[model samples]
Target: MGQHESNTKLIWQVFGFLSIVTIVEVILGIIKPHGLHFTNFLGTSLLNWIFIILTLVKAAGIMWYFMHMNHERKNFVNSIILPLIILIPYLVTLLLIEGHYIHEVMGSYINWKY
Candidate 1:
């Protein structure tokens, strides 16, 4: 019974943390401060980068807590995280390259037509 109660409290804590993070994301998206929106980093706006980073934080938190990754062995955690370290960058690079090519080719037409 004590263990169950402790687990329930932890679950609520995780829930509260996730809720707060999401609320922050929503508020930032709505507010879109000029400084963050206008500044560019790596071809994307700072605001967009913030959204991406916050989203990644939320994902890691979910995986660590809700999926019980925290209870897993160190080797198991490394096994999952290490591959993503390589793959996520590779995939993002692909997206950026393809998106840039497509934008160069089709952006004018799409904007004018629309």
Candidate 2:
């Protein structure tokens, strides 16, 4: 009974943390501060950067707790997470490069009105 109660408490705590982070993400998305929304960093707006970072944090938390990665060996955890850590940046870089190329190519021909 005690163990069950403790597990329930832990579940609630994790739920609360995840909920708070999600709420913050949603609020920021809706109310995008002008300062953050306008500033560019690494070819993306600061607000976008914040969203990416918060999403990563939530993913890490879910993996560590809900997926029980925290109990695994360090090497095992690294093996599972390292690829994701590497893949995201690589994919983002690819996306940025492709988008820039497309923009440049289209700009030459389109004469965008806006």
Candidate 3:
């Protein structure tokens, strides 16, 4: 049937898009270009920032298309997404702050042999 064919096409398209995003993530992780790897942004390496952003993008795409959020009412979608939008940044900020504090404290007391 035409509907079945269309569904199949859509499935393939989603699969392809997700696959491409994953491949890009993997390649970037492996290669870790020196410029990106060395640069710091928001207390994290540029590479780490890229990974986080790409992960969010992939998650949003999956939720919107695969999980059928796109068909839901605007308010329903906003209700679900708003918490995540707020939480992710909050969590990231906490992580960076705590990590920096730990690094500073450890550096002050710990001696390196190397």
Q: TM-score for each prediction?
A: 0.83, 0.80, 0.82
What C-alpha lDDT values do all the predictions have? 0.84, 0.86, 0.88
Per residue, candidate 1 scores C-alpha lDDT tens digits across 15-106 of 89989999999999888998998897776678877887788788899999989999899999999999988987687668767877897899
lDDT of 2 by residue, 20-48 (tens): 99999999988889999889899877888
CA deviation > 4 Å runs, candidate 1: 2-5, 112-114
Worst ten in a row by lDDT for model 2: 1-10
Which candidate gets the maximum TM-score versus the true structure? Answer: 1
Off by over 4 Å in 3: 1-6, 105-114
For each of the candidates, the C-alpha root-mean-square deviation to the true structure, in angstroms, is 2.7, 3.2, 3.2
Worst 10 residues of 1 by lDDT: 1-10
Clashing pairs in 1: none
When sorted by TM-score, best at the front, the candidate numbers are 1, 3, 2
